[model samples]
Target: MHPYLQIMIGFARSGVLGYGGGPSVIPLIEYEAVKNYKWMNSDEFGETLALANTLPGPIATKMAAYIGYKVKGPLGAIVAVTAHILPSLIALIGILTFFYSFRSSPFISGMVQGVTPVIAVMLFMMALDFLKKGSKGLGVRWAMILAVFAFLLLQILTLHPGIVIAIFLTSAFIFATYRGRKTMKQNFEQESREKVQ
Candidate 1:
């Protein structure tokens, strides 16, 4: 099939089936982008996700646009974002009255309850995968500590997520710069010693 059609189908599936809003839709998008299409690897997807979180607007649309642009450029981005949102738009318009009528029904409530745990588990698994990758760079102990610190900042202090992300990004930049300079200096010093000997 053509790439555009594939993009349409992939994003449409994510948009339509993604219950519980943006956060829940992320794993579905990841599956399509990383596993199914092979557009990017997990690491790339994780990095894109982090960057996307730092930006405003809906996460799913941002991801769709990025993946589309990567695949087929500007037109592809337009197609991808449209596909992602169209289903939800049509469904909302078609079912708004029906949903409102049954919103308080036991059947509807039970369905929501059943789906909630599944969404939670999906999110947990995704986080675990990211944590494993993060541990490789940060070390397991530091990874756990940072995870707990993030949790406290988010849950206890009620800090905004964007602020927390900014703090971490700034720290990572500083640490990486320092480490690079240190490595360069050590290499230079070692070469000088060898020349003198």
Candidate 2:
């Protein structure tokens, strides 16, 4: 199959079935891109997800664009984004009108109630996967420390999320710089000792 068509199909599936909005759609997209399609490895997908969160836009759109571009190019991005968005757009205008009218029905209400728990579980599973991935890169000890700090700041202290994020990013940056310099200094000293011999 053509990459363009694959992009359309993959994203179209995600956009159409992605109930409960962005968080739900993300795991579906991850399954498509990382597992089924093999377009990106788990580590790359993790980075892409992180970058998408930092950007100012819908997560689904950001992910669609990234995956499409990776598969092909600029044109692939356009096709993927359009495919992803068009389903929801059409559904919103077409199907949702009927759904809205029947929303008060017991059947519709029961359906929603049933689906909500599934969505919650999906979100929880994704959160655990992402947490494990993050912990691997940051190391278990640092990851625990950072997680505790973030929870305290955001949940207990009621600090703004942006401020908490900035604090953590700065801490990570400083730690990285110090670690790099220490490694370099050790390498230099080792080289000098070898030269003296």
* Highest lDDT model number: 1
Q: How do the residues 44-96 of candidate 2 rate in per-residue lDDT, one tens digit apiece? A: 99778766766677889999999899999999899989999998899989977
Tell me each candidate's TM-score: 0.97, 0.89
Q: What is the lDDT of residue 186 in candidate 2?
A: 100
lDDT for residue 188 in candidate 2, whole number 0-100: 100
Off by over 4 Å in 1: none
Candidate 2's C-alpha lDDT?
Answer: 0.87
Off by over 4 Å in 2: 153-170
RMSD of each: 1.0, 2.1
Candidate 2: the clashing residue pairs are none
Cα lDDT of model 1 by residue, 5-34, tens digit: 989999999999899878899999999999
Please give the lDDT score for candidate 1. Answer: 0.93
